[model samples]
Target: MTTGRGLRGTAAVVGIGNPRYHKRGTSEDSALALILKAILAACEDAGADPRGIDGFVSYANDLNEGLAVGAALGVREVRWSTMVWGGGGGGVAAAVNAAAAAVATGQAECVAVYRGITEADDGRQSYGKGHFPPLLTAHGIVTPAQICALRTQRMLEADGVPRSAMEALTAVSYLHAQSNPDAAAFGKPLDPEVYADSRWIAEPLRLYDCSRENDGAGALLVVPAERARDFAQPPAYVLSGVQGAGPDWSESLENDAAYTSAGFHPALVNRMWDGAGIKAGEVDVVQVYENFTGPAVASLIDVGLCPPGVAAGEFMTVDNLRAPGGGLPINTSGGNIADGFVHGIGLAVEAVRQIRGSSPNQVAGADVSLLLGGPMAPLVSATIFGSAATR
Candidate 1:
C-alpha cells in the first residue's frame, strides 16, 4: 500500500492570482479576458514560465476550457488535463486534489486549478446550462437556494440549530469584506438591521444569507513540495485532500437523506483528517465555501470543526471567525458571500494568501489552513494547506 493520506506532503501551492474583481456586467462578455489575466498573474506570482505549464484542472461548470486556455497561455505542451465532475461549488476542493494528485504521481510537474466566471449586469452567475434533470426543478425547488433551504430546514427541525448559526457565518463574511478592497461587498455594509430585514429567499434563509455573484476569475498553481522552495513565494504545502459523496449522494431534492442532512461531510472528514495527520483544533484558518449560509453552518459541524448537530450555532460566532484574536479565522478574503463567487475556487486563492502572510486580513502566524468547497450533495471536497515550516 502506498499508505497514509496518499495526497499529503507531496504537492505545494506556490502561487495564486485574481484579476480586479468586478460586479457582474461591469466585466460581462469578457470571461475569456479574465481567465487569461488570472493565468498570467498566477504565473507571475509563481515566477513560472507561461510555456512551462504541464497540467490543468477545474471544476465541472467552469467557463475556462483547459486545452483552449493552455493554448492561450502559450503552454509548451499540456501533458495532462482533468475536470472534477458535477456542478455547484462542491468541486473546488476536489479540483485542488486533482492537481495535487497529478503532481504527486509525476503525471505533470506544474499544474494549475482555476475557474473563470463572468455574468450580466444584474449580478447572477449560472452554475450550469440546462437543468441536469431528475432534479426537483418541476416543484418550486428549481435553484440551489430553494434546494439548500430544505436541507437547512431539516437541520433546524432535527439538528437543533437556530437561525442565528447561519446568520453568524453570513455576518462574518460581510465584516471581513469591509476590510478587503478587492471584494464586491466592500463598504457595502451588511449590518445587523440589514441582515435582520433582508427578506427571505427561502423560508428561514434570507437574501443576505445567499452568496453574492460577481464577474471574475481566480487561479492557483501547484507543484511538487520538494521543488516548491524554488518559487518566488512561500509555499503552502498541500497536507492532504479527498473527495467523496454520501451513500445516496446522487439523491438530491425530494426524500433524499442529503437533502435533509449535511451533504458529504461524514464521508470526507474522517478520511481527510486521518490522512493529513491533523485535526480541526490544529487548524488556525479556514475558507469554507459560501454557496449558502445554512450549508456552511452544517458543514462546520459535520467537518469536525465543532461537534455534530445543533450546538455548532454557539461555535460559529462572528467574534470567533474574525482574524487575530479569533480561535479560528474563516473566509478572511470575504468568501463567496462577500468576495466574488467564482464557483468557490476563489476561496483557494484566499487560502494561499493566508499561508503566504500577504492577506490583507492576515491571521498572525497561521501555520495550518483548511479550505472546503461544497456541502453540495453527492460531491464535496476539502484540503489542508500549511506553511513550509508548518507542523
Candidate 2:
C-alpha cells in the first residue's frame, strides 16, 4: 500500500555544506560560529542568497538558536525556527522532516537544516551522569555504550546474529572513509585483525565499533521541489522523512522486544517506504548512523535491509557494503563511525551527495539514498532521498 502523500517530493535539498571538521575539543571556533559558517557555505552551494533563508531547523538541543544564527547570517527575517526535542543523533532525520514540512506548507520559502558541535570536556559526557533513569543508572548502565550493549548482546546471543557482522560494519565504514578526504579517519584503515584486537568498550562492542566525536558543522538547504533545479547543484528530492519510536521503547531496556530492536518500529518502517513509493530493495545506498555498530546491525534488520538472525552473517560482508560494486553501498562518506560525528547531520548531507552524484565514494548510478538515524534512543528517525529522476 503506497501512501504517496505527506511531504513526499514536495521539497528537495538544493545544497549541502560542511565548513570543516576538527577533532573534539580542538576547534578554535565556537559552536555558533561553525554553524553560521556552514549555513553560509550551504547558501553559496545553492547559489541562493543568505537573506532568502527564513526558516531553520536543528536537533540534539543545539545551543545555537535559530534567530541568533539568522542574525549572524543577516537573513531578511526569521519566519520559522524550531528544534527537535531529545539528545543524541535520533533527531537527525526529524530535523530534515521539519525543514521539508516548512517548505512544503509555505511556512518558509527557503529553510536551512543544520547542526554544529564543539565538544567540551564537561559536555556530552554528561549523558552518563543525569540522563538515564535511576533504576538503570544505579546498575551502572550509565553510558550509551553500556545501554546499547545490552541490546546488541541480545541480538547476538538470542537472535543468532554473528559478531562478525558488526566487525564488517566497522571495517566497511573505515574502508569508505579512506576515499573521503573530509573523513576524520581519511588516511587510517581498519582490517579484521585490527578490529578483533581492539579493546572492548562494552562486551560485543569494541573501541573501533563506536563513533568518533568531532567538532564540526553541516548544513543543507531545502526549497519547493519545483524550484530545486535553479540551484548550483542537482536537487536531491525529499522522498520521505519519518520519525518515531517503537512500542515500549520509553525506558530503552525494560521491554524485551524494544530492548533488542533498533527502535525502528515495523509500522514506522512500512510508513516510510510506503510514503516514499519505494521498497527497501530500491534504495541504492544507505547511511545508517553508527553511534555503535551493534545497534546499527539491529537497525539493518529492523529496516528490512538485512534479514533477522544469523542471516546478517552473509549479508553484512565488507565487499557487499562498500561502494561502486557493492550490493548496498552504505555510509559512502564514512558515516558516524569513520566520518566526523556532527550529531549525525553529516549522514544526511552524505545522503544528499549520493543523490547529487557528488559523494567521495560515489555509488554508481545511485538514485535513492536512505539515512537511518541513531538507534535505541527515546526517539528515532529515517529519511529517504532520491535523484530528480525518481521525483
Candidate 3:
C-alpha cells in the first residue's frame, strides 16, 4: 500500500464559490438562481466554461428548489448525476460521488456541485416537506433542532459530557464567524448565559444551540488531479473519500446507543485513511458536519481522530486552542453553527477555502483537511485533502 500523508488516486478541487452567507438581497432569490450564481462563479474560479461541465451533483432535496435546477445550470451533457439520500449530510456524499466517477470512468474531466437554500418567510417553519417521516412531523418533531437535540442530550447523559463542553464549541463557532465576513452570524459573539438561557427548542437545545436558517449558496469545481494546477488557485487534492449507512430505521442509528456495528463513522474513516495513506493523527484540520454541537464532538471521537470521550473536553474548550488558526483548527469558517446552514455545502466550501489559505478566517498553514458529513441517521461520508500535491 502507499505510505505516508499522500493521496491514493487522482482527483482535486479546483474552484470554490459562494454568495454572501446572510440575506444577499431583499428580492428573495429563488434556489435555482442562488445555485446558478454560485456555479458560474465556481466555474470562473476554476477557469472552466460553464457549458464544459461533464458531471453534476446536488442536494437530493432538489424538489425543494422546484425542480430542473441541474438542467437550468446547463449540465446538458451530464454523464454523471446523483442525489444523496441522507438528511443534512449530503456535502461529503456529493464530493465522494464526483471523485469516484472521475477516477473510475475517466470521462468527466470537470464536475460542478452546488447547494442553495432560500429560507421561508417568518410565518413558515424552515423544515418543510419531503424525506422526514410523517410520524416525526405529525408529532411535531418538525424542526431539526428537536431531533438533533435529543441526540445531544443522550450523549451528555450517557457519556457524562459536561454542558460546558457544548458551550465551548458553540462559543468558538461564534468567535470564528465574527471574523468571517461572508458568514451570516458575522460579528455575533455568543456568550455562556446566552446559550444557557436562549429559547428552548428542545430540552437541552436552546435557540443558539441550533444552526441558523439563512439564505445562501455554495459550489465547488472538481477536476482530475493531473489537471488541477491549470484550473484554480492552489487546488486542494482529494486524497480519499468513502460513504456508509448504518442499521435499520428503528435502530435510530444516528447515536452511539443505536450502534450494533463498528464506531459510527469510523468505518468510513478507516476506509478513507487506508485509501489516502494517512493516519488519523496526521490530519491537520477537520470540517465535520455539525447540525448540532454534540454530533460535532461525537464525530471526532468516532473517527479515531481524538481519544475516546475526550473530544468535548479537548477540542471544544476556549483555552484549548483548536479554533481557527489554533493548534488543530476544527471549523475555520464557522461551520453550520455560525456560517449558516446551506444544507451541508457550507462546510464543503469552507474546507476548500481552508486548504487554499484563502478563507476570510483562514487557518494558518493548513496543509491537510478532513471533511465529513452526517448523523445521517446512519448514513455518512468522509473525504480527505492535501495541499494541491497531485499535480
* Reference-based TM-score, model 1: 0.94
Q: Rate the local accuracy (lDDT) of all candidates.
A: 0.81, 0.86, 0.67
lDDT of 3 by residue, 116-168 (tens): 76754322233333445666778777666666677677777777666666676
Candidate 2 versus truth, CA RMSD in Å, comes to: 1.8
Q: Highest TM-score: give the candidate number.
A: 2
Please provide TM-scores, in order, for all candidate models, with all chains considered together. 0.94, 0.96, 0.87
Per-prediction CA RMSD (Å): 2.2, 1.8, 3.7
Off by over 4 Å in 2: 1-4, 126-130, 251-253
The residue ranges of model 3 lying beyond 4 angstroms of the native Cα positions read 1-7, 24-27, 64-76, 120-131, 134-140, 248-263, 321-325, 376-378, 389-391
lDDT of 1 by residue, 1-391 (tens): 1255487788999978887677766785477678778878998999999788899998847766789889988899998799888667878989999999999989999998888777752235477443345556656566778778878888888877878778888888888888999988888878799889888889778998888777888889999888898889999988889787766775443556555555655656888887778877899899998788888877777787855555776787889888867888889988999988888877999888889999878999988989888875447888888886763
What 10-residue stretch in candidate 1 is worst by lDDT?
121-130
Give the per-residue Cα lDDT of candidate 3 at 105. 56
